[model samples]
Target: MKRRIAREKAVQILFQLDVAEVQLPDAIDMVMEDSTGESTEFLLSLVHGTLENLPAIDAEIQKYLRNWKLDRIANVDRSVLRLAFYELMFDEATPDRVVLNEAVELAKLFSDEQSYKFINGVLSAYLQAGATTTES
Candidate 1:
């Protein structure tokens, strides 16, 4: 699968996990059903890695959220942030800009009009703070 498609799928699976409380493996299987000849490995990595590091990711997002609480953020927007933040913090191979752009794009597609701005602002803040560069 194209990385964009995989990323979008990752967001969807993440959203499903949050709202439906689906098991990780089951969620992966469910999303993969419609996909064929598309490498699921990347998608699975994003889903599992984001879930594995959710607490830390949420904490990072909270720091940049300003006045808004985490739970008050839209589920789709939160999922997009979580996935992008995972890439920013852990996937060193992909540049931060790519992750941020993809995340904003995903936000545009999956979330409300104003959500992209909020997502972009929060991510830009996270990057500017260099919060993930020293992750070890």
Candidate 2:
């Protein structure tokens, strides 16, 4: 599957894990059940890495949130941030700009009408905080 599609599925699987109280493998399996493909390594790393590093990711997200609590944000929005943060903070192969762009796109594709801005704002703040370079 394309990375975009994998990201969409990652958001869904993360949503399940966050809301439905599903295990990591079960969340991944549920999302992949309908997908027809061979390469899932990217998707697997996303969900697994997100879950594995959830505490740190959530903490980073909390730093960006103004008044909104992590749990209080829309599920889809939260999922998008988690997935994006994993790439932004953990995955070095993908550029930080790409991660930021992908995050906004994910929010636009899945969340509420205004969620894209919210996602963009949060991720942009993360970048500005000097987490890392966005240079490719």
By TM-score, the best candidate is 1
Clashes of 2: 0
lDDT of 1 by residue, 1-136 (tens): 9899999999999999998967877877787888867778888888888988999889888999989999999999999999998998888878999999999999989888799999999999998897755472
Name the best candidate (by lDDT). Answer: 1
| lDDT score, candidate 1, position 101 | 94
Q: What does the lDDT read for residue 23 in candidate 2?
A: 83
Q: Rate the local accuracy (lDDT) of all candidates.
A: 0.89, 0.88
TM value for model 1:
0.94
Clashing residue pair totals per candidate (backbone < 3 A): 2, 0
Q: How many pairs in model 1 have backbone atoms within 3 A of each other, for residues 3 or more apart or on separate chains, i.e. clashes?
A: 2
Q: What are the models' TM-scores? A: 0.94, 0.92
Q: Per-residue lDDT for 17 in model 2?
A: 79
Distance (Å) between predicted and true CA of 48, model 2?
0.6
